[model samples]
Target: MDDRRGSVLVLTNLHDVTTDIVLRVLAARRVPVVRLDPGTDLLAEASLSASYGTGGQRGTLRTPSRDLDLTRVRSVWVRRPSAYDGPPGLDEHDRRFAREQAFWGIGGVLASLPHAHYVNHLWNNRAAEYKPAQLAAAQQVGLLVPDTLITHAAQEAREFVACHGSGVVYKPLWNSPYRVAGRPHSVWVREVREQEITEAVAVCPHLFQARVDKAFDVRVTAVGPWLSGVRIDSPDLDWRRRQGLMRCEPVDVPGAIDQSVRAYLAHFRLVYGAFDFAVTHDGTWYFLECNPNGQWAWQPPDVTDAIAQALADQLEKGSAP
Candidate 1:
C-alpha cells in the first residue's frame, strides 16, 4: 500500500446496488477504493488503529499503530450502513460491547481525521435526522412548507387536526422500522380522520401535518450543484405506496427551489440529498423532507450514472492539485 495516495471508503449495506455504481466509477478512474460494511471486524480493527488492509480490487486500506495519513485520503462516501449482525459465538454482553464501541468508534476516528472530505459528515447526518430541524432549515431558506405540529398531548393533536381537516397526516418522529405480521414493512402517506387520532399521542409525540393536495411529487437529487430528477404523478397520497400506480417524467426544478435546496445542503455540510417536494393544484411547491444520504440508484440509469460522475468529480477536484 502506498502512503501517498489513499482510497475512498464507502460505509454501506452489503447488498446495496449503489455501492456497485460508486465502486465502478472509482475503478474506472484508477482511484483505489475501500468498501466495507460498518459492522465488520475490519472496521473495528481499523477504528482501533490495529493493522488492516488486505489487498483486493478494493485496494490496500489499513490502519497500523500509526495514524492514517488523512492528507492522502481524497474523500469518504457514507451510504446506508445497516446495524451490525454480530459474529457467531459471542454472548449477548460481548455482542453489545462490540456493537456499541463500533458505532461510536468509526465516527470518532473519521471525524478526527483532518483532510478527508466526507460526502456528508456522519455527525451532521445524525443531527439532521430530526424532522423539525430539517423543516426549520427549509423554511429558513425561503422554501414554502406545509403547516405542521408536533405534540405529545392528544388534545393538541386533535386541535391541529381540526384546523388541518381530515386531510391531516401522521408521520414518525424518527425513521422507524415498519413491520406487519412479524415481518418488515414500510410507512406510506395516508389521510387521517379525527377518530384515527384516538390515543395516537399516548404512545409518543406523533408528527401531524396538513396533507398537501398535489398534482405530483418532485424528487430532487443534489450531487454538488448537479441537482436533477423528475416529477412523479400518482393517485396515492404517498408515491412510495403507489409504486405501480405512478408515472415519472423529467421536469424543470424552479430556480428558487433549486437555490433553497443548495442552501439546505450547505447548512448540513453535505454533498448529496434526496429531497421530497409536493406540487399543489395551483403549482405551489411545498418542502417535504430531505434524506441526507438517500438512495439515488433507484432512479433511471442515466440519472444514477450522472450522480456517480458528480461524486467522482468531487473526489478528483478535492485531491491535491
Candidate 2:
C-alpha cells in the first residue's frame, strides 16, 4: 500500500487557530486531510458505521464535507476537542445516555483505526496529564525537578512551606474551568506564605513546591525527534500573565537536556509535548510540567513555521506497520 495515500484525520473544535496553522502546512504538501469535531458533528453533520469480525474491523465515517474510510486513515491528530453533549431537546438522563453511546461507539472506532499513527495517542495524552506522573518521569529520565508536595492536610502544607526557607509556590494540579462574575479566570502560580495555608487546604489536595530562583524561563516544544526551545525573559513570576510584555527568542537546546526530553516523551508514549522549565543563573533547567497537547503556534514566526512543518512531515509519513 502507498503510505501517503490515505487522509490525515484531525480531531478539534472549529475555533482552533493552532489547528489552522497545521492544516495549512498539510495543504501545501497536498496531503489529504479530514478535519472534524466529533463532539458536535456527530449529532447532525456526521454519521459513523463500524463493524468487526473475522475479516477485521471496517467502517466509513461521513461528514458534511468528506467521507473517511477507516482502514485508509494515514494518521490521527487528537487536538483540542469539545465534550460530546449529544443531540438537543432531550431530558437530562436521556441526553447523558446518548452522549455515552456516541462516545464509546464513535470514539472507539476512531481509536481502533489500524496502521494509523497518532501525534500523541488519546490514551497516552490522558495518562500524561497527571503532574505527579510527569514529575516522576522527568526525575527518572535525569531531569531536575523541584521539591514538591501534594497534600490535603493543613498541617502538612504548613510544614512543607516552612521547610522551604527560600519560598514555596502554589499551583493547581489541573486548570479546570473557573469563572468569577461570569468572566473566566485561571489559577496562576504564585508565592505562598505559611499563614496562607489554612483550613481551606484540608478541603482538597493541593500542590506546593519550593520556588525556583531562576534567571529566565524556557519553553521547549518537542515534535517527534525535533525540538525547538524558546527563551522567555519576563519580569513576572508567571510569564503567561504578561505574555505581551515578554521577550522571546530561539535558543539552542543543550545536549543532555535534549536526550532527556526525547526519553521523557518515549516514557509517556507521546510524539509531541510542550515542556516548561525554569533556568537558574548558574544554568540549571528545572522541570516544571509538560502539556502533551500544548499550544505552539503562539511563538515567533520562524519557530512556529518549523514546528508546523515537522508536524506535517510526521502526519504525511504516516505510521509503519
Candidate 3:
C-alpha cells in the first residue's frame, strides 16, 4: 500500500460555487483540504514559518497561505484565481503588487512547483483553448464531429452558411463574455439562415458549424477514471437554451465513446472534463466540446455523489483526481 500523508489544496477564486460541495464531500471522507486565495492578504509570516518547518512536522494550518509540501499534496484543484481589484484600504502601489502577486507572483511560483496531481494544468488548459486544436484532437480520437468553419471573411462565412442550408449554427470562437446593458448575455444555439449573415461576418471571425439535429443531449462527466453519463432531452435546439424545460436520464456510456473520452482526457492531460455530445436520430453520437472545468453540480445528486467519490478515491490513492 502506498502510504503518504498530505492535504489537498484547492486554489480557486471566491466566485466559484462548487468549492462548498467539493469541500463537503472531501470532509465526509476525512480528507484534509486547504483553500488558498492569492489575492487575499498574503500571510507571509505563516508561509515563511511553514516553509521553515521540518517536513512532515505537525503545525497549525493558516489561512490565505498554508505550508504544503509539494510531494505530500495528493491533488490540486485549480479554478480561476480571485480577481484582485485591490484591497479596500491599501495604497495604489501596494494594491498593484497584491493584484500582480495573485496571478503572476505567488500564483505563478506555486504553479511552477513540480509536485501534486493537478486537475488540469494551466499550460495544458491554455494549449487546449483553441477550438481548432480541440476539434482536430476529437477527430483524431475517432469521435464523429460536425463540419465546422472558423472564418473572419464575410464571404467564407456566407459560403459555410449556404452549404449547411438551414442546419447551421454560429458560436463565438473564444467565448468572450458579452454584455448587453451591463448584463451578461449568453450565446444560444439558433438556426443560421443566409439572410442573417449580411454584415455579421464583418464584425468578427465567428465559428459556424453544421447544426446537428440532435435526438438528445449527453453530458459525460469524467473525473479521473470514473465517468458519469447523463442524457439530456429538451424541445429546444439546445438544452441550455431552455434551462427549466429539459429532462435528464442517467444512462450507460457506450464503450467506444467512453474510450474516446478517456483518450481525449489523456490527450489534454485533464483529470476532469464535462463533455457535451449530440446523439443524432440515426443513433450516432457526435462530440461537441469538452469543458475542462465544466459545472457538474446541476446533474442528478447521485451523479454528483459518484464524481465526488471518485475524486476522493483518486486523491486518497495519491493519483490524479
Candidate 4:
C-alpha cells in the first residue's frame, strides 16, 4: 500500500448517497480517495499514531489494507460522523469510557491534520453548527434575522412567546435520538403555543424564534467561493418537512445577501456551507441557519456537478500555487 498522504479522506455515515457521488467525481479526476464510517466500521480497521517532538510532529493513519502518511493528506472532508457505538462486549459504564477515549484519541488526531485542507474543519464545523452562533454571525454580517430567544426558564419562554405571538417556533437545540415507545425519535422544529411554555421547558434550553412570514425558502449551498441557491416555494412552515410539496428552482443570489453570506463563512473559517434563508412575501431575505458540513448532492444535477468540481479544485490545489 502507498504511504503517501495525498489522498482525500471522507468521514461519512453508513449509507450516504452524496459520498458516492463525490467519490465518482474524485475517481474521474484520478484522485485517490479513502472513505470510512468512523463511528462504526472505522474503529475496527483504522489505527492512527501521532507524535510530537522537538523537531516536528508526525503521524500515520493505517488500515489493514493501506497506510496514509498524515502529513501528505490533501483534504479531509468531514461529513456527518455519528457517535461511537461502543464495544459489544463491555458493560455500559466501561463502554462509555472506551468510546470517550476513542473520540478524543482518533477523532482529535484527525482534526489536527497539519497539511489537510478540511472542507469544513471539524472544530470549526462544530462551533458553526450551533444555531445561536449561526444567528449571531448572520446578524453581525448585516443579514436580516428574526428575533430569537434561547432559554431554560419557563417564564422567560412564556414572555418571549407572548411577545412573538403563536407564530413563534420552538427549535430543538440538536436533533438527538430520543427513545419513545422503545423506538428512536427526533424532535423537529415546530410551532409552539403560548400555553406550551410550561415547566417542562425548564428541563433544558430551548430555542424560540419569531416565525419569518415567508413566501418561500432558499437553500444556498456554497462550495468555496462558488454559490448555488435553490428557491423552494411551499405551504409548509419547514419546506424540508414536506419537500415533495415544494417547487425548487435555481435562482441568482442578490449581491448584498451574497456578501453577508461570504462574511459569515469567513467568520467561521468554513470553505463550504449549506445556508437556509427565509424569504418574506415582500422579497426580504432573513437568515435562518448555516450547516457547515450540510449535504449538497441532493441539489439539482447541474448545480451538484458544479459544486463537485469546485470541491475537487480546492482539494487538488490546496493553498499553494
User: Candidate 1, 263: how far from true, in Å?
Assistant: 1.0
Weakest lDDT window of 10 consecutive positions for candidate 1: 50-59
lDDT by residue (tens digit), candidate 2, 1-321? 565798999999989989999899999989999888889887877888888999888889898887888889999999988888988999999999999998888788878888899988888998999999999999999999999999999999999999999899999999989999999998899999999889998888999999999999999999999898999999899999888999999998899999999999999999999999999999999999999999888799999999999999889999975
Whole-model lDDT, model 4: 0.82
TM-score comparison, 2 vs 4, better candidate: 2
**CA deviation > 4 Å runs, candidate 2:** none
Comparing candidate 2 with candidate 3, which one achieves the higher TM-score? 2
The global C-alpha lDDT for each of the candidates, from Candidate 1 onward, is: 0.75, 0.92, 0.75, 0.82
Q: Candidate 3 on 120-201: residue-level lDDT in tens?
A: 6767777777788889999999899999988878788888888875489876677678899999998876678777787757
Q: Which ten residues in a row have the lowest lDDT in candidate 3?
A: 43-52
Model 1 TM? 0.87
* TM-score of every candidate: 0.87, 0.98, 0.85, 0.93
Per-residue CA lDDT of model 1 for 1-321, tens digit only, reads: 332266576677668887788788878888876665656635456433422346311222354443334445667777777776565578999888877776676556655444566777788787777899999999999999899988888888888888875379877777689789999988766677776677757887778899888888999999887899678888878878757788777779999999999999999888878899999889899999998878777666777788899987766555344
Best by lDDT: 2
Each model's number of backbone clashes? 0, 0, 0, 2
- The residue pairs in collision within model 3 are none
Per-residue lDDT of 1-321 in model 4, one digit per residue for the tens?
Answer: 222338888888777777777778788888888776667765677777899889687888787778877777778888777677777799999989989988888788888877678888888988998888888889899999899999999999888888875389988878677989999875767899888788988788999999988888999988788888898887778777776788778988999999998999999999999999998889999998998887777667888888888877776655442
Task: Give all candidate RMSDs, comma-separated.
Answer: 4.9, 1.0, 4.0, 2.5
